[model samples]
Target: MVIFMLVKDVMKKPITVKDNDDLTEVIKLFREKRISGAPVLNDDGELVGIISESDIIKTLTTHDEDLNLILPSPLDLIELPLKTAIKIEEFKEDLKKALKTKVKDVMTKDVVVAKPDMTINDAAKLMVEHKIKRLPVVDEDGKLIGIITRGDIIEALV
Candidate 1:
């Protein structure tokens, strides 16, 4: 017999983050919960965006335009170790600034969501089409209720 599984049956009560929350605290939460991403909620508790490890990684690799445009002098090039040390120090400073960034600054604002009554198969198709791993499950009034992930669907099938 074929069973039709709805998103509500497998979706987990979402662990959400506030849009104005700092990245440093969000990172701590992600680590503690062992979650790769979470839906961003506003003060009114509406899903406003989504954040993931991918977004954090993007911040790390964001290059400084001025730094990239400058060409090191011949003397500076000869002092390779000194150049490397300076670069490391600058990178450290950048990381510090990045950590203080707010969730809204880096989150994907145009979020794709799923309804609780939606079928698991349909949700999976949405995941594949959007190239996303999770979908925030919302209510009729577009309020976040839970989260559904690829893992959840896989586990439900087993």
Candidate 2:
């Protein structure tokens, strides 16, 4: 028998970032939590935007023309020799500037969300349609409550 499940049944408590949070702090949070993205919330705890690893990488690579030349593509940095690509001091200074940059500055503002009552299958279809890996689950009032990931649906099926 196939069972339909609601988002609340499989969603995990959201790991959120504040709009005013420093990019450096956000990056640290992502690293520590091993998350690729997070919902950006305002002072009232309302979801305003979303930030992902791609955004951070874009910010780092595009901020300076020198940096952009060194790491033309996001993956190029991994293959390029770091010492030849950028000086340690320059990289550190860039990181410091990045740390001061607010999450709101780099977050994707036009966000797609899902209600807690939405079915897992429906959510999965929405994700596929939008080409997203996850969806933030919101309450009737539109407050972020949890997040459902692609992994969640697969786990539910198992």
Candidate 3:
């Protein structure tokens, strides 16, 4: 199918975070916006990076990479529920602690961006190649103006 749609046709104003923003604030912004990721901007409002739930998840789990959070055993049946509850509480605490860091520390600096005039097909290609869910739409001088995502493209196409 030939798509004449341009990125600007479907791009939405970006929900952004500052480089120095604390993860706590960023996390809250994400939750409030119901967004999985956002463009990161510098003090001069230049798009510098991108932060996503993957970044937060990686930060939260610096060490606990093993899936062996709990082991199943016949003798452990009675303790499973209590252990699970405790693990959940511990994870919450870890999340709070992880928020002490700045957004720049964990944000992906090597971001792939889209131009307003770019075709939706081209933008989709970039996203697929970069394995990113969202693409920041930047102007000629690289100023972030809007953002587009897989969902946005799909919605627009339909």
Candidate 4:
């Protein structure tokens, strides 16, 4: 089952945003579409950065005091089981950031993008090395064509 699977078998068409797009618009898209992140593009549709809920949360919390009260920071919450603690800490960190933050500020600039033709194993290896959950599939010109998530990998493996 694994040998027969590849990234092309499960990748999703990527939704993207421009650098000039306001953070409000990004947040709206994420909420309405139930997406966590998107590829940031320029006028030419070149892949600029990747933005996610984590990015948006940073914009709201890090730069705004009032927004801070809107969500409880995990850092301020009581301790939890070890297994759940890891996920909780990550969530708390995202909640403590501000909205004025730019994609450049929060995005992983040294991104581990993938080619559509790459095998699933190749993508999985990159994911492990970079500690990322998704890969922005790019064309020869480095424009985003699709995206593959760890969920996609699990699906492929099964």
State TM-scores per candidate. Answer: 0.90, 0.79, 0.80, 0.69
Residue 17 of model 1: what lDDT? 98
- Per-model CA lDDT versus the true structure: 0.91, 0.86, 0.90, 0.74
| Index of the highest-TM-score prediction | 1
Number of residue pairs clashing in candidate 3, backbone atoms closer than 3 angstroms, sequence gap of 3 or more or interchain: 0
Instruction: List, residue by residue over 1-158, the lDDT tens digit for candidate 4.
Output: 58556677789998787776767677778888878888888788788788877666655653323223335569644433453567556656765444444565666556679888888889989999988888999888887889998888888766
Give the clashing residue pairs of candidate 2, or none: none
lDDT tens readout by residue for model 3, 1-158: 43889999999999999999998898899999999999999999999999999998788874544324366677677776787788778878887888898999999999999999999999999999989999999999888999999999988877
Candidate 1: tens digits of C-alpha lDDT, residues 1-158 = 11488999999999999999999989999999999999999999889999999998897785645344258777766776666778889989999999999999999999999999999999999999999999999999999999999999999988
Candidate 3 lDDT score at position 91? 79
The candidates, ranked best first by TM-score, are 1, 3, 2, 4
TM-score of 2: 0.79
Q: Which ten residues in a row have the lowest lDDT in candidate 3?
A: 62-71
lDDT of 3: 0.90
| Ranking, lDDT, top scorer first | 1, 3, 2, 4
Worst 10 residues of 2 by lDDT: 62-71
Report clashes for each candidate as comma-separated counts: 0, 0, 0, 11
Model 1 / residue 32 / CA error / Å = 0.2
Residue pairs with backbone overlap in model 3 = none
Give stretches of model 4 more than 4 Å off. Answer: 63-105
